[model samples]
Target chain A: MSNQDQNLAATVNTTQGSYRVIVGRDVIDDLGTELQKTGLKGRAFLVVDEVMFPNPSRRAQEALERGGYETHVLALEIGEANKNLETVQIVYDWLADLLADRSDIVVAMGGGVTGDLVGFAAATWLRGVAVVHVPTSLAAMVDSSIGGKTGVNIPKGKNLLGAFHQPKLVLQDVGHLKSLPAREMSAGWAEAVKHGFILDAQLLDTFERLAPQMKALAGEEPVAAIRRSVAIKGEIVSADEFETGDHRVLLNYGHTIGHAIEKVSGYGTYLHGEAVAIGMMAAAGIAERLGMIDEELVDRQRRVLENYDLPVRASGLDVDALIEATKSDKKSRGGTIRWVLLEGPGKATTRRDVPEEVVREAVLAILD
Target chain B: MSNQDQNLAATVNTTQGSYRVIVGRDVIDDLGTELQKTGLKGRAFLVVDEVMFPNPSRRAQEALERGGYETHVLALEIGEANKNLETVQIVYDWLADLLADRSDIVVAMGGGVTGDLVGFAAATWLRGVAVVHVPTSLAAMVDSSIGGKTGVNIPKGKNLLGAFHQPKLVLQDVGHLKSLPAREMSAGWAEAVKHGFILDAQLLDTFERLAPQMKALAGEEPVAAIRRSVAIKGEIVSADEFETGDHRVLLNYGHTIGHAIEKVSGYGTYLHGEAVAIGMMAAAGIAERLGMIDEELVDRQRRVLENYDLPVRASGLDVDALIEATKSDKKSRGGTIRWVLLEGPGKATTRRDVPEEVVREAVLAILD
Candidate 1:
C-alpha cells in the first residue's frame, strides 16, 4: 500500500484501542469466535432490542455460551421514544444483580437503539468495560454501530447523556436484515447513499448499480456495498478524535435538517435515515442555490434515494419551525447551524455563513 | 531523580491531561483568574453544594463573572442517598436550559458527594465538558476531588453508576473548612492521615508536628500538608490509565471494609473518613496476624489517627455480616477481596489470599 493509503486506512483506534469492523452475510454466528480473537475470557452480558429477543439474540447468546462465555440475556423495550436514561437504568440493574465486573464484556444485539443504549451501559459500567455490537438493521450496519459514539437521550435532548466509548468490535451481519421491515430497509439505504455522496463517488455508483438488490437484501453485493459504507464511516470517525468534530462533521451531511424533521414530526413519524434522506435533499438544494454544485448532482442524490424508495420530499410541516429546530441541533454552534454540503460527488465541505433566505428557499424546495 | 525517587514522584498526568492541583487558604477566591489561565472563554455553570451557596459559591461566582464569564449558579442537595441518576437529571435539566455547549465548563463547588455527582454530570453532558472542582470539604479536596473517579450510588451498590472523568483543575481551598463542624473536620483528617499511612511517612510526621494547628484550622502547615496529599493522589491517579486500576488500588488502603461499613451502617451513620479510620485499624490487625506488618507499626497508625480525633475502632457491628459485605466491595475480584495492608508507614501492598478466619478476627478485634 502507498503511504497515503496507509494513513487513510481507518482502524477503530484511539486511547480506547484499535478494533476490527467485520462485515459479512452471517458474521453474527461468529460472535463467540470473534470475541475469542480479542482474547476475552469473561462472562457475556447480552442486552438485546425488544424486537430482536428470543431469535437472533438467542443465537448470539448461544454462540457466546458455546464459545465458553457464561452468558446472560436481557431484552429492553426500546425505540427513539424509549431511548433515554431510564433505559440505561434497566441495564445497570441487571449488571449489578450479576455482580458484573471489569472482566465482563457487554454484547448489544439489534439495531442502532440497542447498540447506542447498551454501548453506553458498557461505557460507564465499572467506569467502562469492553463492548461488541451485533448490528441487525441496515442503518446500524452502515452507521451507528461502527463509531465509538454511544449515548442515551434525555428529556432535554438526544444523546445528551453518554460517553465516547468504542466497541471492541462491530459485527455487521446482513443475514439479520431479512427480518426487518421494508421501510426500515429503505431508510438505511439513505445513509449508504449519503456516504457515497460525501466521500466516495465509486460507492455512489455501486449503490446505483445494485439498488434493487440492496433494497431487497438479496445477492452478495449487499454485503459488499454495506462493507464499503462501513469503511467510509470508519475513515471519517477515526479521522476525528472526540472534539472539534470537524473532520467527522462531513458525516453530518444531511443530519442538520434531518434531525429537525425528526423533531418537528415528533421523532415517531420518520425513521432516522428517512429524515436524513429528506435532509440530504434540502442540503443538496442549499448547495445548488450557492452554486457550490451543478443541478446534476442534486438530481443524482435524489435518483439514488428514489431507487431505494427513500423520500426526497417532506410536506405539510412548518418550514419555519424546521429552520428553528436546526438551530437547536447538536451540530449547531453559537446560534449558527454548520451545514455540510457537497461541491460535487465525493467532495463535502461545511459552511456556517449560509444566508437564512438561501436556506429557507432550499428547505422550501424539498417540502410539498 | 534517583531510580526510587522517579518511581514515586507522582504526577497528575494521564490521557485526561496533567492538571494543576492548587492547595491554598483562599484559592476559591482565585477561581475566575485560574479559569482564565486555562484559556477558557465560555460560560461557567457553577453547581455548588447546597450548604456552600450564598457565601463562598457567590464569591467564586463573582470571581468568574469578573473574569468575563457569564456564569449560572445551581445549588444541589447532594448526599449518598440522593446521589443517583435522578440527581444527575437535575443537572442535565439545568445545562439544557442554559444550552450549555462543550465550550462551557461545569464548576463543582462542594464536598465529595457534590464533586462526584457533578463530575459524573460533566462527564456525560455533551459527551463531556471540561470541569474544575472547587472542593469545599477537606475529605473532597484530599481524596475524591483530585481523582477522576466520579459516580452515583444505585440501589445495588455505591458508585455502581458513573465514569472516570478527571477535572481540568482541583482548587483545594482550606478557608471553607472554618464553617464545617468539628466532627466533620475530624472525618476529613481521616483521609489525610490514611494517605500518610499508605504512601508518605513524612506526611504522618508532619501531622504529628502540627496536630493542634490542623485540628484548630490555625496555620500555614495545614495548607502545605493538604498540598502533599493532593500531590500523592494526583500521582496515583495519573499513573494508571482507564483499565489497569492497579496503581490507583494502592490509594484504597482502608476503603475495602470502609465501604462495607458505610453500606452496613445504611450509608448514613459514619462519615467516609470515620469508617476508613476504623477499617485502617482492622487492616493493621490483619497485617499483624499475617506477619506482613508489626504491632508497633499498627500502634503508630492508631496514635496518628487519634491525634486528629479519628476513630480507630468501630464498635457493635455484626462481624460476619461485615465479612460478607467486604466480598461485595467494588475492589473484590472473582470472590477474592484484594486487601491493601501496610508493611510500614510508607509502604502498602495488596494481597488477595488473606484467609477468611484471619480477616474475621482482625475485624472482630475492633468491635465491641
Candidate 2:
C-alpha cells in the first residue's frame, strides 16, 4: 500500500501459481504481514538453517507470533551434501509428527539449499500446502525464491528430484545479506550479474559500475541490481512456468556449466554463484568461438566476474567429467547438451547443435 | 482412428495439463500409437509391478516395443509397506543409471501402488517427465490413474508424501481386470460405485441392475461402468485440478473414512475400494442420521454394495484411531475433519460443522 512496499516487492505470475517477492532492508518483520494477506490461517512451521545467522530466523518467528500465528520453528543443520531425499524425509517426518494439515504453512527461511529442501517438503506433504519462502542468500532472493522450482539433489546429480510448486509468498530481507560472508555475498552477485548478461545490459552496467560497492551491500546499487535481477527472472518464469519453452532456458545462461562445475568439483567446493561465475566464462568462450560475441565482450564478462571476487575458472578440471556432468543436466535432453550462449550482453539463445568438440574446447579453456 | 478408439477413450483436461485415458479390451496394445499422437518421441522406460498379475505388465512392454518404442522394463517387488520414499529412491537410482533424460518417457505399468510410486518418481525425476500410466487394477483405472495425484506413504501415514504429476496418457485394458482376483475387482467396484453415489443417480441405477453381474467383468456393462466412472472423475478433476475448490472434494465421498480404515487397519489390510465400500456405509449412516437421506434409500445403497460383494462394515475398529486418522486426511483443514456427506444419492456436500458426536456414531455403527 505504501511506496516502500511497492518498491520493495514484486509479484511473480506463472502458469503454475503466483506469489509476491519482497526485497528490502530489515523486511523480515513484513513476512507475517504479507502472509496474513493471503488469508492462510494456520500454524506456521518455520524451517531455518541453523548454520547461518539465527537473528533473522528468530525475528521471523517472533513476527509471525505477533501477527497471531501459532509459530513452530525447526532449525536444520543442512548444506548441499544433505540436500537430498534423506533430508526431505527428515522434514516430512517432522511435519507429520507436528500434525501439519493442509491449511498449515511451511515457512522456509534459509539459502537455496534450505529453500529447496523445505519447499520440496511443502510441495509433497499432504500433497502440498502453502509455502512462504524467506530466502536469506542473494542467489535465493534473485532466483530460487522467485520461481516455484523446488527440488532436492541426489547422489548422481544436482536438483535431479524436484517439482514445479510455486510459493505462496517470497519475503526477501536484504539485511540478511550483511550476515553472509563476503565471498558468499559476492557469489550471489554472480547470478545477478548473469541477469545482466542474459537480459538487461543497463542492469549489467549497474553491476559493472558498482562491482566494488556490490560486495559491501551498500548504496542503492546492490538493491537496484537485486531488484532488476528478480524482475528479469520473474518475467522469464512468468512466460514459461515450466521449462517447456525457450523463454525459461535463457535464464540459464551460465547454469549449464555452472551446475556441472558444482557436480564435478563437489557441491560444497564452490557456492552456486561461484560455479556460475566460472560457467559464465565458459559460456562466453563458447559464444566467442562461435562468432556470436566479440572477444572484447567475453573478456568484459570475465573481468566483471573477477571484479566481484568470484571465480571465472576452476583449476585441475577434467574435461570428461565436466562433459559427463553436463550430460546429466536437465537441459541435456534427447542425449544432446543444449548450451545457452550469449550473443552479447542482454542477448542469449539456446542451441542444441553445439558440436561436442567445441563444447570440449570451451570447457577445457575454463580450467586452469 | 477406429470406432472403438473413439468410443473407448475419454479426454481429461486439467489446469495443470491435459491427457487422455483410453479404456477398453486390449487397449494396452495401443500404448505406442497413442504416445506417438502426443508428439512425445523417446525411449519408454517401463516400470512394472512384479507382484500380482505380471502377464499384463509384460504384454504392455511387448506392445510398446511393437509400436516402435525402444522399451526398458524394471519390474519392482513392491507392496504397500514398500511404497515410501525408500522405494522412490530406488527407482530414482535406476533411472539415473539408465541415463534417463527429460525427454524420455517413464511408463508406469500396474495398479494404484505401482502407478503412484512410478508417477512420483516421474514427477521428481528431472523435475518431472512424461509418464504414461498402464493401470491393470480396477481402482487405478477408474480413480487414481485419472488424477495427477502421485505419492508415497510415510511411517506415520499413507500418501503423506507425494506430488500432483499428471500422466501423459492412461492406457487401461479391461482384459487385465480379468487377471485380478474377484476381491480386487470388487474393491475397484467400490470406487466406481462411489462415483454413482456422489455424482450420477442414473449410473447408480445401472450399477444396481448390474450388481449381480458386475464381479464377472463380463458383457458391456462393466466396460460402460468403468467408462462412466472415468468420465465423472475426469470432469471433476478438469474443473478443480488442484483440490483448492469444492468440486474436487466431492470426489472424496467415501475416501475420508476409507483412508482412515486403511490407515487404522494398516494400509495392506484391505484393498482401497473395500475400505471405501465400508466408508460409503459410514457416510451413508451419517447422511441418514442428519436426515439428508431416508432409511429406505440408505438400505437400498447398502443392498447394492452387498450384491457386489463389497463390505458394508468392518469387523473391528478403534473409534479414536479412526477419528484421529480422519483428521490427518488432506481434506481436514484447520484441525477440523471435513466430511463429504451425501445430501442424497448422486448429491454430496463437504461439511466441516458436522457434530463430532454424529461422526463417532457413524463410525460406531459401521464397526462390529
Candidate 3:
C-alpha cells in the first residue's frame, strides 16, 4: 500500500453502516477515492461557509469535479448567526433548483456552522441524502464534524432545530488550519480541552504539557491531538447516538452556560469556543464554590486556558441579559437552570434546580 | 373511570412515553385529562391552523383551559404552503419571548400542516419542549400526528426542514371530522388505504368494503379505521424511528410518486392525501406492468380510490413537469428513482432503475 493509504488505515476505521472518519494532513486529496467508497451517485454539492469558500475549499471542490462528480457550490455566510432555520431554507432552495437527489452527496466544506447547516439540509433533503463533511476549521475538525450533531439554530436556542443524521464520511485535513485565523484556532482548542475535561484527565495534562507548542501553533502534534479529541467524541457519540441517556449529556459540560452566552451575545459576539472557554471556567468555579472541587484545580484550569489566551472571565456584558438567556436555555426545565458541573477531572454530572442566585454569583465572580 | 377512558384503555395502552389516539365523538372533553399526563408546567402554547381556529379546535382549547392548563393560542395560516422555515422562526421568536420552558408544552391543534409546523417548533423550542398533538383533520388524526414526523417544508421540497421529534401525546378526536370538507376527509382515507396496502391485506379488504361509507363520511367505523391506521403507522415508526431499514420505507408506498406530484403542482394545489391517491394508482399500474403483481389488484386499488372521489390519474398535468418533479423526489437515489412497488398484498419492495420508459408508460396509462 502507498504511504497515504497506510496513514489512513492507521487513523480511521469503517463501522457497520460504513460510516468513517478520515483524519490526517492533506486528507482533502483523498476526497474522490473516499466518495467512490460511499457508493453515492450523481454530482457533489459543495456547501461551504463564506469565509472558507475562496481559499482552502477550492482545492477540495476541484478534486471532486476531477473525480467525475457534478459539482455545485452553495457558499453560506459563516458563524452561528447564520446557523438558523431561515439560512437552512436558502441552501435547500439552491439544492432543490439544482435537482439534487439521494444519489448526490452534500460536501460540508467549512467549520462547525457550515457542517451543521448543510448536514441538516442533507438530513431532510428528499427525506434524507448522503453527506460528506470536509471540516476546515480547528473546532470542526476536532469536535463538530465527528458526532453527527447536524442542525440549525432556533432563535430561542442554538441547535434547537436539527436531527441525528450521521455522515457517509468525514475528511479532516489539518492543512486547512493554516488558513484559519489565530482567534478561531484558539477557540477550537477549547473543544480539545473539553474532551480532556470530560473523559481523560491525562489528556488535560497532555494539553498543559503541550500548551507552549499549541499556543505557538507549532509541531505535527496538533493534527494528532485533534484526531485523538475527535476519536474521543466519536466513541461517546457512537455509544449513545441519540443522547437518550447520561453518556451524551455528560458531553454538555460547559454547553449549558456556553449556549446561553452565545444566544445573549447574538451568536457571533463571542466565538463558540471562546464562550465555551469562559463557561467551562465558570463551571469549574461554581463547582469549587459549592465545595465540589478544590480551588487548586480551578487555578490549574485557568492557568492552562491563559496559555492559549482563551478568556476565562466575562466582563462588559449585561449581566441581566446573560441571566435571562440562561433561563431561556434549551436545557432549562420548569424555569430552573441545569448546569453540567465537573465533580473532578474526567468526571461530570448535570445539576438541575441550580439556584438563580448561585448562578448569578458564579457569573459575577467571573466578570473582570 | 369515565366511559371514554375505559373504552380507550381497552384498545390502546399508554406508557411513559406512549401517547394516545383519541377517536370517536366529543373526545375534546378529555383534553384536560390528557394535559395532566403531559407533565406540563402551568400553561400551554396552543398553536392552531386558521381553518381549525374557528371550529372544533377552539372548543378543544376551551376544554384545555377548563382542565386547568393556562392557554395561549397561536393561530397560523392553513395548508402546506405555510409550513416553512419563516413560519417556524416566527413561532420560535414568539415562544422565546414568552419564556416558555421545558415544563410547558406546545399543543398543535390543527390538520397535518399545523401539526408538522408546530411540532417542529416544539421540538426546537428550548432544544425541545413537550408537544401534544390535537389532530382535527382526518389526515392528521390517522397519519401525521401519530408518527412524530414533525417538520416544515423548504422551498426545495416537502418536509425537507424537519426533525423526528415525537410528541408527548397525540389527541385525535374523530368527532372533529364532522366539520371537515368532503375532499379533505377523502384525502385522509388515502393514507389509511396506504397503511393497509403496506401492512395488512385484511385491512385493505375492509377499506374496499367500506369505500362507500368512507365516501359518504358515514358510519362509526371511520373512527375505528383511523385508530387502526394510526396504530399501524405508530408501530412501524416506533420499531424503526429513523427509517434506517426497510420497515419504515414501506410507509412510503405511494409517497414516492405522490411527493413528486405535490412538488410539481406546488404544495397547496392538491391535498397531500389526494396526490398520494393518484400516486398509489400509478404505483399499482407500474407493479402490474412489470408483471410483479396481478392486474386484478391494480383495478381493485383504482376502484377503492375512485369510490372516495380521489384522483387516481395524473390527467391534465404536464407529463414533463410531473417527470421533472418525480426526479427531484426525496426517494430518488444517485439520480435514480426508488419506487416502492407491491409484489402482492402486504408485500412491497424498493425497486430502483425501473426504466424511465416503464415509468412513462405507467404515467401515460394513468393519464388516459
Candidate 4:
C-alpha cells in the first residue's frame, strides 16, 4: 500500500496455490500486524527448533497471540536426521491431541528441516491446514520456504518423499540469520550465490560487493541482496511450480552434483549448501570441458564460493558412486540426468547429453 | 472420437491436475490402446490386492507390456488394515529399488484402499508421478479414483493422513465387479445410491427400477448405472475438488455419521458402504426430525437401501462415541460438524446448526 511496503514484500503464484513473502526486521515484532494483513485466520500452533525454544520461539508465540490468535508453541531437535516421517508422526500426534481442525494454522518456526517436517504435517493434516512459515535460516528464508515443496526423507534417499504444498504466508525476519552457526550460515549463502550464478549478474555483483556485510548480517545491503535472491527464486518457481518443465530446472545450477554429493557423503556429513558449493565447482568444470564456458567463469564462480567461506572441493567421495547418485537424482527424467550448467554468468541451461565420463571427470576433479 | 467412446469415458478437472475416467468392458483388454491415447507414458509399476493378482493384475501387466511399456507387477494384501504407511513404505521401497525416475508411472490396480495407499505413494514418490488407477471395486471407480483423495489411516483415525493427489487416469472394467463379494457389491452401491439421493432424482429412479440387475452386476444396466454415478461424482468434484466448499460436501451425504459408525464399530466390523448405508438412514431420520423432508421420501430412501441388501441399521454401538467421532471427522471444520442432510430426494445441503441431541436421536433410531 505504501512505497516502503512494496519494497519489503514479494508474492509467489503457483498453480497449486499462492502466498506472500515479506522480508523485514519488523516482520517478527510486527508479526501480528503482518498476519492481519493476510487472508489467513486460525489458532496458531508454532513448531520451532529446540535451540530457539525460550527466545525467538517464545517471542513468535507472543507475537502470534498479539495478533488475536490462540497460539501454541513446541520445540524439537531438528536437523537432517530429524527430517523424516518419524518426526512428522510426532507433530501429527501432537496436533491430533490438541483437537486441531482445518481452520487451525501450523506456524513452522525453524530452518529447512523444520519447515519440511512441520510443513509436511500441515500439508496432510485434515487434508491440509494453513502453514505460515517463519524461516529462521538464510537457506529457508531465500529458497525452501518460498516454494510449496514440503516433504520428509526416507532411508531410501534424501527428499525422495515430499509434496508441493504451498504455504499461506512466509514472514521472514533477517535478524534471526545472525544466530545461525557459521557453517550453517555459509551453507545458506551457497544457495543464494547459486541464484546469482544462474539468474542475475547484478545479484552476483551485489553479493561480491556485499560479501562482508552479508556474512556479518550487517547493513541494508545484506537484506537487499537476500531480497534479490528471493525475487529470482520466486520468479522461477512461479514460472514452473512443478519441475515438469525446463524453466525451474535452471534453479538447480549446482544441485545435480550437489544432491549426489549429499547422498554419497551421507546427509549431515556435509551441509546441503556445502554439497552444492562443491557441486557448483563440478558443474563449472563440466561446462568448461564442454566449452560452454571458459575457465575464467568457472574460476570466478569458485571464488564466489570461497568469498562466503563455503567449500569449493569435496574430499574423498567415490566418483563412480557420485555419478550413480546423479542418475538417481529426482531431476533425472527417464534415467538420464538433466545437468543444469552455466553458459555464462546470469545464463543457465539444461542438458541431458552430458556423458557419464565427463561427469566422472568433473566429480573426480572436485574431490581433494 | 466416436459417440460410443464419448458414452464410455468421463473427464475430471481439478486445481491439482486433470484426468479421464473411462468405463468399459474392454478397458482392461484395451488398456494398451487407452494408455497410448493419453499423454502419460513410461515404465509401469502395478500394485493390486492379492486377490486380483493372478487375474486382473497379470492381465494388466500384459496389457501395459502390449502398449510398449516396460511393465512390473507386485501384489500386496491391501485392505483397510493394510492401508497404512507401512504398506506405503513397501511401495516406496519397491519403486526406489527399481530406480524409478520422474517420468515413470505407478498404476494402482484394485479398490479404494489400494487406490489410497498406492495413490499416496504415487503422490509423494519423486514429489509425485503419473498414477493410472484401474479400480476393481465400485466405490473406488465412482469416488476415490476421481477426486485425487489419496491417503492412509493412522491409529488416530481413518483417512487422517493423506493428500488430494489425483490419478492421471482411471480405467474401469465392470467385469471385475462381478467377482466382488456380495457384501462388497452392496457396500459400493450405497455410495452410488447416495449420489442419487443427494443429487439426482432421475438417477435415484434408475437405481430403484434396476436395483436387482445393478446388485447382480448384470447386463447393460450395471455399467450404465455406474457411469451415471461416475458422472455425478465428476460434476461435484469438478465444481469443488478439495471439498473446501459446499458442492463437494454434498457428496458426503451419509459420510458424517457413516464415518463415525465405521470409527466407533472399529473399521473392519462394518464395510465402508454398509456403514454409510446405515448413516444414510440415520440422516433420513434427522431430516425427518428437522422437518427438512417428509416421511414418504425417507421411507422411499430406506426401500432403496433394502432393495440392494445394504444395511439400513446398526447394532451394539455406543451412541456417545459415535457422536464424539462425528466431531472428530475430517469434515467437521471449526469443530462443528456440517451435516449434509436432504431437503428432498434430489437435494442436499449442509447445516452446522444441527443440535447434539438431534444427532443422538438419529443415531439411536438407526441402532437395532
- Using all chains and alpha carbons, the TM-scores for the candidates as numbered come to 0.95, 0.95, 0.84, 0.96
lDDT score for candidate 1 against the true structure: 0.85
Residue-wise C-alpha lDDT for candidate 1, range A33-132, written one tens digit per residue: 7788888888999998878878878878887877889999998888878888778889999999998998899999888988888988888888888999
State the lDDT of candidate 1 residue by residue for B93-120, as single tens digits: 9999899988899999988999999999
User: What tens digits encode model 2's per-residue C-alpha lDDT throughout A38-141?
Assistant: 78899999999996536767889988987899988888887887898888878887888888887799999899989988998898887788899999988888
Determine which window of 10 residues in candidate 4 chain B has minimal summed lDDT: B1-10
Q: How do the candidates rank by DockQ, highest first?
A: 2, 1, 4, 3
What DockQ does model 4 achieve?
A: 0.68
Which lDDT tens digits does candidate 2 get at residues B260-364?
Answer: 999899767888889998998998889888988898888988998888888999977899999888887777766687788888878888877888789899999
Q: How do the residues B1-368 of candidate 4 rate in per-residue lDDT, one tens digit apiece?
A: 22338555578888766777888675687676677777667888888889998887888888888888888888899888777888899999999888787778899999899998898899888777888899999889877788888888778766778877887778888888878888888888899999999999999999999987787776778888889899889888889988877899898889889999988887789998999999999998998999999999989999999999998999999999999988878777776788999999879998889999999998899987
Error of 4 at B119 (Å): 1.0
Q: How many collisions per candidate? A: 0, 1, 4, 1
Greater DockQ among 3 and 4 belongs to 4
Alpha-carbon lDDT of model 3: 0.76
Cα miss at A340, model 1 (Å)?
Answer: 0.7
Model 4, position B169, has a per-residue lDDT of 77
RMSD per candidate (Å) reads 4.1, 2.2, 4.4, 2.2
Error of 4 at B148 (Å): 0.8
